[model samples]
Target: MFRIETHAISLVRRGLMAALIVAASVLIGATVALAESHGFAGLEGGTFAMGSGKHYREEAPVRQVTLQPFSIQKTEVTNAEFAAFVEDTGYVTTAEKDLDQSDYPGLPPDLLKAGSMVFAQPKDPVALNDINLWWRYVPGAQWRHPRGPESSIEGLEDHPVVQVSIEDAKAYAAWAGGRLPTEAEWEYAARGGLDGAQFSWGEDYDPSEGWKANTWQGVFPSIDTAEDGHHGSAPVGSYASNGYGLYDMAGNVWEYVSDWWIPGHPTKDQTNPGGPSKTLAEQFANSAVGARHVVKGGSWLCAPSYCFRYRPSARQPAERSLGSNHIGFRIVRDGVN
Candidate 1:
């Protein structure tokens, strides 16, 4: 009968779809295995793999990939390194760029000066819903004065520099004879030999009773537990290294990457994808706002209670010109052959 024939066709379609799913899964597993063959940090302050079957990041998978290799700085760009870049290139960062009424919409007349967001005093607590409570509009909150005018990196030149914008990050990379890593490269490196990992270290948020990366230990905004031995950003290399000897690839500061987030990688076997040149705003008429750049390696402000983004593959984006105490960058240069 005609009805019987239609049922048969539907059954065939379902089987075919199932077959495709299996094939895709197999391909992804094989690709991940290849990466594993190269190296895995294993368990320590070292490896950060999440294991198979478990998803590390939501859309960003650790499955298969054939990518050209590159080197990343083991630690973030230290104040020492950034200071040198400034000396060599005399580059002015976005924080240094002047802003007017245009940059800050619906602002009061007194608040029109060019400034950047610097973390307010935790000693001074305020409501989470209130934006003005936690962030200070600092006149000099650039890579140099991090916490603003009263703050200085004088003795902490070894500390990873914060408040550097995407433009500033690019400038440093150019001067230092390197370039920024793409989102894939940044996450790959952040994993530090650990692939398909939920957190940079492993599946568990804490392990070995050993210290993890620098992050908010106690209540955010107020009362930091300081279990990681310091509050706010620590000196670079303060913690143990991952497989490739990278430090603070997790909580400390978010590093900027070369790629813009493209809803998701559209094809399999994508080689060194740099993300969509067009952004979410361009595609959607209602979305007047869009931040394309991918920020990896989550910052020290991350917490399990609020943001568990210390995981390597974690990402988000803000305007390139945006500055915050929790945002900073690392650099990548041509890797050694």
Candidate 2:
């Protein structure tokens, strides 16, 4: 009788453990499904002047463009959203993968560890021309560890997930059943129904009162006044949304677009302009072989004296494989839903 009772208790405990495992799996599945259903704001896309003649050279030759109706995430992808995707898919970011010496020929073997570029502010004023003064390539600096191995996403669940390569962004978008926004689509949505405005909100940088976005204040690479109440990335929707009810379209982190980087805008009017088809190799034949993608909307590091790219027309090229703390992405889906 004693032997039978002991065996029965063991079987019951085993059954309870299996049941708990099944319950946990169900909870995880539910969480992933909930995250995949992120809200998107619909835009009645129409004709708009795509580029700006007043800003950088790349934005020149301002041309007209027409776009189909689409829906885009109201805010940039947050850390919590990305965590859910990773949990569901077991996806590993490029920054987390071991570095290939073949891709970085001259880099030392010791420096070939998995890592991502992180923004480190200098103690003193530095020259604006060289970005190395502020950007540091720290090992283990993936999205979860924005600064380095010591850092974490503890209180940053609501903050935009940074240090994500274009490939990583594409993977997340795919899992979410969406795609990265085109350059024209991103710019059009960023405009918030306002045509050819200098800034996403309006013409003035700091109109009437205080800072409207998370852009840097004071000096670049050295001091940040934090006039916008944030030194780095602010929580999504921390500031006011634009005319079309989209948030962080001007400043926060530079959001990646689906289009590749081109030197300048097209002269002729384009219907849903999708940028050039030429590979990064063809476009940068004279330079390095690595191709780059277009990243729009300036980051919190953008200052008036240095990178004044917080405007809607602003754009920059980011290397395809590299991820930086100041770079992130949002998703868009075609149709009016």
Candidate 3:
């Protein structure tokens, strides 16, 4: 009887262990799901005008595009969020890696340090024509140290994680079980239920009523009146959210899209138009042989006098291997389960 009782107690203990393991797994799964869905805003995507006739040539000849239901992050990926990914994955960003001298044939060996391009405001007024005047390639500048090696993200955890390359963005998206939004999807989301509006908020760029976004106020390259209350990149969701309840779609930082850089509009009305399947090098024979992705919206450097690309129509090419202080990204989830 004693032996039989002992066996029964051992079986009960084993059963309890199994139940505990299952419970722990369920809790972990719930935690991960919560983390992934934290900032995502669902959108019942539909057709919308993709580009603008009033913007740059690349944005001209606006075409209609239709998209399926999807979910996108309400705000750009924050530094604290990115830190969690890095801690979980132990991933190193491109800005943390040494520059490949082969890719830059004429660059000096000493100058090929691991860093990123940082936007340093000029002490005096400088020419808006040349962006090089204010933009500096600071060594040891990465997402952790946004300005340079000396800078730290201690107090800026809530701010968008800048200095992350397109590849890094993709990696983060993949880890989070999502992907970067296509150019069309990005524009559509940026529009925020408004069609062909000049700005994400509306047709007007007014800070007097209160800043709608984190864009340069006073002048380009030099004078920043801080009329919007922020001299540099503000924390994500600093301004009012758009119609779709999405924040920072206009400025704060340029966001990477999944599509490659194309100069012209779509050929026809496309349903869920993903940019050219071919890489930029393949699509444009004369273009540099590298991954050139489309970066949408604009950064804090964008001003009325200079680059007024803070609108939904504005688009720019960003090299995949490089990251900048003004560049970051948001993720999108296709189809709702």
In model 2, what lDDT does residue 316 have? 83
At residue 131, candidate 2 shows an lDDT of 67
Could you give the candidate ranking by lDDT, starting with the highest? 2, 3, 1
| Whole-model lDDT, model 2 | 0.78
**Model 1 agreement with the true structure over 1-337: per-residue lDDT tens digits:** 0000111011100001111111123333433333233222322222222212332333444345434556666677766666655554555666655545454455564334444677665575556655455566677667767887678777666677787767777877787677887776777776666567566676676535888788877776677888888788887778887767677888888888887654344444455566667555246212433444667777777767656677766766645555667777876655452
User: Candidate 2 clashing pairs?
Assistant: none
Q: In model 3, what lDDT does residue 233 have?
A: 81
Ranking by TM-score: 2, 3, 1
Clashing pairs in 1: 31-64, 48-200, 50-197
**Which one wins by lDDT: 1 or 2?**
2
Tell me model 1's lDDT, rounded to 2 decimals: 0.60
| Estimated TM-score for each candidate | 0.75, 0.87, 0.86
Name the weakest run of 10 consecutive residues (lDDT summed) in model 1: 1-10
State candidate 1's TM-score: 0.75
TM-score of 3: 0.86
Which lDDT tens digits does candidate 2 get at residues 221-290?
Answer: 7999887899989888888888988899988999999887776787999998787775642464224434
Off by more than 4 A, model 3 = 1-38, 100-105, 279-291
